[model samples]
Each structure stands twice: as C-alpha cells, then as structure tokens.
Target: MNQLDQLKKYSTVVADTGNVELIKKFSTQDATTNPSLILNAIKLPKYKNLLLKSIEYAKKKNINLKETVSLASNKISVDIGTKILNFIPGRVSTEVDSRLSFNKNLCIFHAKEIIRMYEENGIKRNRILIKLASTWESIQAAKELEKENINCNLTLLFSFAQAKACAQSGVFLISPFVGRIYDWHINKYNLDSINIENDPGVKSVKKIFNFYKKYSYKTIIMAASFRNINQILELSGCDYLTISPTLLSELKSNFNKIDKKLNFTIKNKTYKNKITEEEFRFEHNEDIMATEKLSEGIRQFGYDQKKIEDIIIKNI
Candidate 1:
C-alpha cells in the first residue's frame, strides 16, 4: 500500500485545497478551504470559470453591485465547496469571514448565512463544517451553532487554552496548525536545525491530543497546515489530518509502511475546568507564540479576503 493508503488506515485524510481536481486525484474523504486558498484558486486560469460563475450567480440574484465584494466572496466559497462536495463523500469546510472573528453575533450570522447558501443548493448541513478562527468569540459562536446541528472546524488554533475552550464549548473539531507553529519557533529561536521528533508544532498537537483523549473530550483533533510529510506521519492516528496536495501526492507516490503515532486512553486528568473569559484571555496572552500566530493568521486571512473582494469590485 502507498503511504497515503496506510495513513488512511489510522486517520481520515482531508484535502486542504480549493481545487476540485486535486481533491479528486487524492480521493480525500473531506476537503477544507479558507480565504487564502480560495483567493489563490480563483487567480488560477483553470479556476477562472468558477470565479466568473460566482459573480454571475450573485448578479442574477439582484445582489447590489456595491456589495458584490462580500456576496462574491461568499458565493465563490459556496460554489467551490459545492463542487468539492460532489467529489468527496464527507464534509467540506467553508470558513466565515476572518474580519468577524471577534464578533460573536456576526460570526453566528455569517455562519448561518454560509450554511443557508449550501442548503439552498441542496447540500445538507451535516455535510458542511463551518470553519471559524479559534477565537474565544468564535468558539462561543460555534457552541451556539452546534445546538442547531451545525458542526464547526476551529482553525488557526495554536495553544492548549484554545483547544480546551473548544472542547469545553462542545465544538465538532479543532484544527491545530502544525506547520505554522513550527515556523514560529524556528524563526524565533534561529535554530540552524531541529529534530522532527521534537518539533514544536508536532509537540503542540500531541499535547492537545493527549489532553483531549485523557479527559475524553469529544471534539475531534484534526492536525493541519503541515510543512512536510514527516509532520503528517507523526500524527497518523489523529482524528483527521487536512493535508495539501503537494504532500498528499508525495504520500501517494511512496509505498512505505506508515506507523501510527498517536494513541488515546483515559488517564489521570480533570476534564472539567471552567475557563472564564478573563482567564482565557490571560492564558492565551501568556503563550507568546499562540498570541502572535493567532493574530497574524487572522490578519493574513482578512487581507486575502479583502484582495478577493477587490477582484470582485473590479469585475463589476
């Protein structure tokens, strides 16, 4: 069996792309897309049809030209996600606006809007995971949406505090960015070299996985944003791994035996610790890397979103 097949024995492989062809090639069970990925995809010549189709759909609905940016962005996501859904048997995550990361009400409002768009096109809510940044507000918004049977995938999660909050709030899944965490440590420490076994990003996910397992938190852990195959292999037994096409292709080419790296069992740990809003903020602040990465991830996504909106406005 190829490494990709072996990895699938232990984890559900998700394609981390906006390109339907790539997702189909990998036969990924699920797929995830963000503003950056969508923006990048529409810029490609092959995906230009998707971009034009989204704008046309919005225009036909009598959407305001001035607000085409927002509508175009949302339609593009749904259009891509709808396409992806036809190929993949499982869910496709469509993220809410990163600019609304801190606003609970707006996040909820947009999340529903995104889901409604999917449902309007005949995709059930069960097959969609609303992607949200791992902000406290976003988590709270996810909790409320969960009550209405809307599952969420919390992205840009960098710290244990964020994971704990998500688990406590009863989210469906949390995506801890393995590559981004490693990038921060390598740049900050100025390390000429580092051990993959002891990679900071790898360890962060391990910690969260162990805690979640030990305490029996039902929120799924999907380690994501991998820089290499080693990081993906390291978390082989995670609940899921959303991987890019580059690494997925690498795995598909290598017919090697992949070993499971994570195992879960109940251990000595208290599952219940009510984290107040102040404590949550303080704990997140104490982790320098998480603090910096979370903010940076939001800013970059917001910038990409704005760029896509600009493209829509220009087209109008």
Candidate 2:
C-alpha cells in the first residue's frame, strides 16, 4: 500500500485546504480551512460561483456594509465547508474570525453563528468542528461551547501550555502547528537544514501526544501546518494529521512502509493539576517561539480574512 494508505491505518488523515477538489482527490477523512486557505480557494475559477452565491446570500441579510462583509465571510467559510463535507465522510473544521479571538463572548457568538449556518444547510452540529484560535479567551469560549455540544478545534496552538489548557477545557481537538514550530527553531539556530529526527516541530507533537496519551485526555491532537512528508510520516500515529495538498500528493506516490510513531500504550497513568488561566498565560508567554508564532499566525489569518472581506465588498 502507498504511504498515505499506510498512515491512515494509524492516524486519521485530514485535508488542510479549502480546495474541495484536492480534498476529494486525497480522500481525507476530515478537512480544515482557515482564512488564507479560503481566500486562495475562492480565487480559483471553479469557486467563482461559490463566491457569487455567498455575496448574494450576504446581500439578502439587509445589513450595513461592515456587517454584510462579516456575514459574507462567514457564509463563504460555511459554504466551502459545506461543499467539502459532501466529499468527506468526517467533519469539516470552519474557523471563526481571528479578529474575535481575544473576545470570549464574541468568539462564542461567532462560533454559534457558524454552527447555525452549517445547520441551516442541513449539516448536523456533530459534523462540524468550530475552529478557534488558541487564545485564553478562545479556550474559555470553547469550554462553554462544548457544554452545548458544539465541538471546537483550537488552531494556532504552539505551546504545551496551550495544549494543556485546551485539553483541560474539554475541547474536542487542538491543532499544534508543526511546520511553524520547525520554522522558528530553524531561523533561531541559523541552521541550513535539520533532520526529521531532531526537528523541533516533530518533537513538540510527540511530547503532546505522549502527555495526552499518558493522562488519557479525550481531547484529540491533530498535528497541523506540516512542512514536508517526513514530518507527516514522523507523526504517523497522531490522532489526526492535517496535511496540505502538496504534502498529501507526496505521500500518495510514496510506497514506503511507514511505522506508527505514536501509540496509545501507557505503562503508568500520570496525573497533573488542571491548568489555570494565569498559569497558561504565563507559561505560554515564557515560550518566545510560541508567543511570537501565535501572534504571527493570528495576524496572518486576520489579514487574509480582510482580503476575503474586501473581495466580498467589491462584488456586493
């Protein structure tokens, strides 16, 4: 069997793209989308109608320009997610606006809005994972949403503290950005290249995987933002690996036998105190890499979010 097929035996493969064609091609179990991916996907000729439809939907709301753009952005995300869901049997992760990441109440409200849009399209809440940033506010918002049976995927996760907080908050999943972590370490060390064995990104995911498995946390770890196939192969046994089309294509052609790099076996059960909000903030701030990358990820996503909104504004 190909490596992609082999990897699926160990971990659920999630397509990390807004392009439905690629998602269909990979046959990923689940799919994830952010502002950037959604922006890129809508640019393609195939999605022009999708964009037009979203604009029309937004116009019907009879809101102001700013509110109309917001509605259209949410509609585009949900529309793309709804389309992706038709191809994948599992859930689709539609991210909340990163601009609302710092506002717990806004985050909660936006998440529910996305869920409502999905449900209106005949998609069940269980088939949607409302993606949110890994800010403290977002985490708290997720905790509340979970109580209402709205599952969430915490994105832009870089620190162990973030992972701990998310799991403790009873989130459905957390996406630790593997490639971003690797990039930070590589630039910090001024290294030309790093081997997969010593890669910081790979190590981070492994640590989180072991910790979650040891404690038997039901919160899933879906490794995201991979730089290459080796990183994906290294995390073969992760709960889920969200891979882009480029890397997915690489895995699809490779026939190498990939071994499970992570496992559920824990010799001894371990326990730790629940992470407090203050502790999460302090520890996460201490990690320079996580702090910088988390901020950078949010800014990038917010920028892309605006770009999509601009497009909607132009058409509407």
Candidate 3:
C-alpha cells in the first residue's frame, strides 16, 4: 500500500485546498480552505467563473461586490466544502475571516453566518468545521460556538499551550502547523545548521501528538503546514493531517514502504501543560517564532483577503 494508504490506519488525511475538482483523485477524507487558498483558486481559469458568478449574482441583487464577494465566496466555499465531503464522507473545514481572529463577537457572528450558508445549501452543521485562528479571543468565541453545537477547527497553532488550550476548550479539531514550524527553525537557525531528522517543526508536532494521546484530549490534532513528505511520514498516525494537493499527489506516487509509526492506543500519558488563557498568552508571548508566525500568517491572509476584495471592487 502507498504511504497514504498505510497512514489511514490511524490518521485521517484531508485535502487542504480550495480546488475541489481534483480532490477525489487524492482520496482525501475531508477538505479545508481559507482566504489565501480561495484567492489562489479564483485565479485559476476553472475557478474564475465561480468567483465571477458569485460577483454577478450579487451585482443583480445590488449587493456591493466588494463587501459581498466574501459572502459569495463563503457560499462558494460551502458549496465546494459540501461537495468534497460527499466524495470523502467527512467534515469540511471552512475558515472564518482571519481579520476577525481578535474580534470575539465578529468571529462568532461570521461563524454562524458561514454555517447558515452551508445549511441552506443542504449541508449539516455536524459535517462542517468552522476554522478559526488560535487567538485567545477566537478560542473564547469558539467555545461559545461549541455551546451551540458548532464544531470548530482551530488553525495556525504553533505552541504546546495553543494545543492544550484548544483541547481544554473542547474544540472538535486543532491543527498545529508542521511546515510553519520548519519555517521558524529555518529562519532561526538559518536552515544550514539544522538536522532534518531533528527539525524543530517535526519535534513540535510530535510533542503535541504525544501529549494529546497520553491525555486522551478530545480535540483531534491535524498536523498542517508540511513542506515535504518527510514531515508527513515522520508524523504518521496523527489524528488527521491537512496536506496540500501537490504533496498528496507526490505521496501517492511514492509508496516507499511505510508503517503506522505513532502508537495511539498507549495508556494516557502526562504532559506538563495547563493550557489556560493566561498560560497560552505567556507561552505565545515567550516563543518569538510563534509570535512572529502568528502575526505574519494573519497579515498574509488579511492582505490576500484585501487583494481579493479589491479585485471584486474594481471588476464587479
């Protein structure tokens, strides 16, 4: 069996992209999307019409495209998300606005709006995971949303405290970024003085994985931001993993004999962590890499969102 096939014994593999057309070929269990992926997809010829269609539909209703294309793309995101769920038989993660990460009320409001849009289109709330950043406000907002039975996927996680905090909040899923971990190591150590086997990103996720498994945390850990297959293979048998399409394809093609390396059935283990709000704040503040990446990730997403909005305003 391919590495992807082998990893399936324990871990669920999710396709992390906005393009739904090729999702089935990957045999991904679920799909995830954010403004950046959606923005990238809009540029593709196949997806352009969808963006324009949403814009045109809004134009007909006199809804300002700039303000409304987000609504439109969100609707589009749900449509694609629901469609991919059909192919994979799992939950689809649709992200709320990254700009709203720090705005608790707005995050809750938009999360509900996205869920409502999905529901109207015949998708159920259970099969949808609202993606939020790992900010304190977003975490609080997610906890409130959970009270309403809305499952959330907290993304852009880096620190152990973030994972611990999210688990304590009882979120359905938490995606601790792997590749971004590598990014920090590369930037910090200049990439030349590092050992790939002992790479910081790899060690980071493994620690969280062991902690969650040892403690039996309810929040599933989906390792995200993988730069290569080595990272994925190293972190096999994780709760779930959101891999880019290219890596998924590459993994499928390279079936180098693999086995489930992560032992999930082990008895509960102890991780010296108390993932509270203040703990999360202090931990995040102390980790320069996490702090930098959080700001940089948010800014990049915010910039892309603005760029997409700008495009809609000029064209529609």
Question: Who wins the TM-score comparison?
Answer: 2
- In Å, residue 156's CA in model 2 sits off its true spot by 0.6
Candidate 3 weakest lDDT stretch, 10 residues? 57-66
User: In candidate 1, which residue ranges exceed 4 Å CA deviation?
Assistant: 60-66, 267-270
Evaluate model 3: give its TM-score: 0.92
Worst 10 residues of 2 by lDDT: 263-272
Task: Look at candidate 2 and tell me the lDDT of residue 111.
Answer: 92
Superposed on all Cα atoms, the candidates' RMSDs to the truth, in angstroms, are: 1.6, 1.2, 2.3
How far residue 59's Cα lies from its native spot in candidate 2, in Å, is 2.1
What tens-digit string does per-residue lDDT give for candidate 1 at 193-214?
Answer: 5688889999999999988989
lDDT of 2 by residue, 1-316 (tens): 9999999999999999988888889999999999999999989989889899888888898989888889889998999999999999999999999989999999999899999989989999999999999999999999999999999999999999999999888999999999999999889989887999999999999999999888878899999998899999989889999999999999999998889988778645656688888899999999999999999999999999999988888887
Clashing pairs in 2: none
- Best by the lDDT measure: 2
User: What lDDT, from 0 to 1, does candidate 3 have?
Assistant: 0.81
**Tens digit per residue, CA lDDT, model 3, 33-59:** 888887777777776666676676556
Local error of candidate 1 at 291, Å?
0.5
Error of 2 at 44 (Å): 1.6
Better of 1 and 3 by lDDT: 1
Off by more than 4 A, model 2: 266-270
